[model samples]
Target chain A: MKELDPLLHSQLRLAIVSLLLTVEEADFVWLKEKTEATSGNLSVQLDKLSEAGYISVRKEIVGKKPRTTCSLTPKGRDALNEYVRTLKEYLHI
Target chain B: MKTDELTEKESIELISRMIEKTRNEMNGDDFNSFLAYGYAAVAISIAVWLLTHFTGNDMWCFGWFAMFIPYLLSFFKKGKPEVVTYMDRMMDSVWKVIGSMFGISLLIIVVAGAISGIIDFSMMMPLSIIYAGIGTSITGLIINEKWFVWTPLAGLAAAIWMLTCGWTGGSYDNSWNLLFAASFLIYMVLPAHIVRHKISRS
Candidate 1:
């Protein structure tokens, strides 16, 4: 069984998920810019989230340019909510 | 160990925590400064409008005066970085929408001006400025930023009125230049004071 606490543990992945929660969908460049993470690092983190079935990645052409967009899955949203609830509980806020 | 080595879940959790912490630490000082600058620009513009309306002199002078107050205030009141950063995010989003609309409007004006070569290139500068004021005001309303509703309304109204009067040779009587001036005062200066008070309180 995967631990809920483990899902709440990493910083870069946490940033990516939090940003995706606010925006409907974000492009790779946008997420990279907002999080100030390098391309290689963000790519690795995104793959991990995709593997966990927490996010969906789509590649499409925008203005004749190939773009990759990432959106939070239902599972991602639920996991995020649970993580937030637990954090609040821990902080007693 | 490395900053870049966090797991996916761990990354998500860490960012969530950072945002939460950042929001908790937010104070009203930065918001206050933003409002202050906004209002001061507005108030001064309104005062200029009244002066130009009654005295029948050049309104553009007053308009320029009104626009300068916010720039001055921003220079003086440099607040905390966190609050500033948050406010920047909020305002930048607001401004971006306004900017996009303003760009569209400018395209309209440019096409119109080009077709009617009677309108000089120099005129585009003032027209763009006035349209930007109007765009920002409307954007404010859309975003529920009540502090910004007045300046653009005043500007748009003034612009429409001036354009109409110029075309028909009505009350303004070809004094479209003065009306543009008056619009700036009403739109830019008048709102500045209101924004300033709102910011100071918050």
Candidate 2:
């Protein structure tokens, strides 16, 4: 089995990626709300994932309201799937 | 602790809390707004017909103007602010613009009908209402919202009712109002609520 990066193993980052994977795309606010993380915390984790090239960010306006949206990159998706697969193997579920 | 210094567990907990808070904020406002517009379109259309029948006045021109109110409210007010995300706003805007186009078209048709005298002015009311429904439903389909299908279906039913029942023969009876109410309640009101609920959850 391929090893998962320890940096990607953080619980908050895992939840962020997991939620994004299910929804395909989500806003920073959505991620903050969904994962129940503080705005500052979510931002830091997002920056980490973005630096790893696992996620992409886009900023745009919705009805004169500014918003930041995030989507999982191919690498992020692969890493998430691999992480879940490894966990499943370990749990034998 | 500063967010940057917080452990992973704290971050996860915070995000989970925000999602729950936002979800609770989802009221039936959008759903009700849609229903209000749907009902207004039908009611105003019928009211114009009744007024014309009694006063022998050309009130159909005013019906078109009445229909514009709900459409404007939906576009400018409901769901405009809370949809903080860009994609969500884009999707919402697509529906709004489509609805506006229909309103404009219906206004044009009403004016043309009034001027040309091609059809009885009384028929204009029901026709305008039916057209509004058609426009809403088409917009719904364009946005892939299953709830929107009901508007057109209700419009079709309204059109059929208007055609079969003669205008002078108590066609604007209480039963017709009941039917209008039922169509809006079941088709527009219920489905819109369901869709809004789903969007809130996601």
Candidate 3:
């Protein structure tokens, strides 16, 4: 049986990635709102995903405010697809 | 649910929940911006009709320019959405094209009138109503909003009905103005209001 990607097996990281799958990109505030993650925790989690090359993070100044946006990379998407396949396999169809 | 880690079943479930949540959020984006334009289209059509019919002055038909009011209001709408979904981008791009087409059609009318100097605007209203209907119906299909599909179809049908049966005389007939207004009312205003009401209730 295939194994789930450890990076995506966690609840919050999986939630963040799952949300990004349906969108082109999402910003920090939006993700925080949807995931109900604390700013500090969300930032740390996002850093891990970015470090893994599973997601891309961009920071820019918009209207005198710092804005951070995240999008799932193609690598991340493939990992997600693989994770779901593994889950399905473990369940035996 | 736990903040981290999940069983196999839980992982699957969480993914499903997040996807569903994103879809719901797409629907939850306020349709008020669209509704503003829809109602404006209906209102301007009627006002143009009334003014032309009563004053016997075709120049009053230019009142349709007031559509810029809602267009500008929506253009300057403040703040960014928390998340911009694929659906959001798609819908925004679609409407931008439709609005551009509407503008291009106006350019056609203006250029045609400028060369001739008569400025007969009889075709502009009905054509624009059809464009609105197309945009509304397409959006309904993309978002799976049933009323959005049906209402615009009804509007398109009304527009066709008017084109064939509603017109009484020639090119300058005043009835076109009223028909233009009524079709937009059916195509855009009615469905928008209905969907918004349902969204609010739910």
Candidate 4:
């Protein structure tokens, strides 16, 4: 069995990647709403994903407000797919 | 649900839940563009039918130009997408392709009218309905829109019936316009009720 990536083994980060995989890109606010995560926690997890180069984060100002958006990088997608494959193997389904 | 740690089974469940949640967000403006184009097309189809049926003049068929109403209205329909889903782009592309087809069909009708001094949209009408069906069917599949999965097949059946009537001598003088009117009711307005139900519940 392939070992899961430690970086994505946590709950919030994996949830973020899963959401990003489904969307083209997601703003920070939307991610918070979906994950029901505190702003502080979501931001920290997002930073970890960004540092892993698993997801790309873009910050810009819109209407005098800072807006942060996240999208899965190609590496992120590969990691997620491999993770699922490994889980399937473990589940023996 | 957000959390710090998870077992393998829990991770799998998290992925499933997150994907499902995002799919729900695929609503993307409650399908504003679809409803806008659908309603406009239905209204215009009825208008063309009314004008042609009552006037008994081919010139009245010019109301087909009114189908462009949705294209113009698109600029005014506003909804900001917070998270852009892949379906949003696919939905946009499907309508764009159908709009181009509508443009090409209009060009053909205009050229034909200019040459003959009368617009006879015999085949064009059915073709337009077929195009409408294609757009909705693609959209329905992308968004998990239930009505779309089957409505397009119904619309296609209607269009084919129109073609059969038009090709043979069985169709009335301009009653296909009324047939168009009825088909648009199915193609466009029916989805409105479904959307309305969702909005009220939500």
Q: Which candidate number maximizes TM-score?
A: 3
**Which residue ranges in model 2 land beyond 4 Å of their true spot?**
A5-7, A60-66, A73-75, B1-30, B78-155, B161-182, B190-202
Model 3's chain B yields a TM-score of 0.83
Deviation in angstroms for B165 in model 2?
8.1
B-chain TM-score for every candidate: 0.45, 0.52, 0.83, 0.75
Please write out the lDDT profile of model 3 over residues B1-202, one tens digit for every residue.
2357899999999999999888887777678866788778778878878888888998887787898898777657765666787888888888989999988998898898999996666566667778887888888888888887877766676567656653655354677777676777776777778888888898
Q: TM-score each candidate.
A: 0.44, 0.59, 0.87, 0.74
Q: What is the lDDT of residue B11 in candidate 4?
A: 89
Q: Which ten residues in a row have the lowest lDDT in candidate 4 chain A?
A: A60-69
Ranking according to lDDT, highest score first? 3, 4, 2, 1
- Superposition TM-score, candidate 4 onto the true structure: 0.74
Q: In every candidate, what fraction of the native interface contacts is reproduced?
A: 0.17, 0.01, 0.68, 0.81
Relative to the real complex, the DockQ score for model 4 comes to 0.64
Candidate-wise lDDT, in order: 0.59, 0.61, 0.82, 0.80
Q: Each predicted complex: what DockQ? A: 0.12, 0.11, 0.68, 0.64
Residue-level lDDT tens digits of model 2 in B47-102: 75567667766643355466567756656663334224323444457666655656
Q: Put down candidate 1 lDDT per residue, B1-202, tens digits, no spaces.
A: 1234454445445666656644433333233433454455445545555666678664343354344455566556533231223344565676667557556765776788789884333333345446567655754565456646665666566666655654575543324444555554555444555554665676
Which tens-of-lDDT digit does each residue in A1-93 have in candidate 1? 234456435667777777776545667876777678889988988898998988899877755677778878989989888876666555555
| Candidate 4 residue-wise lDDT at B64 | 70
Top lDDT: which candidate number? Answer: 3
- Candidate 1 has an fnat equal to 0.17
Among the numbered candidates, top DockQ falls to: 3
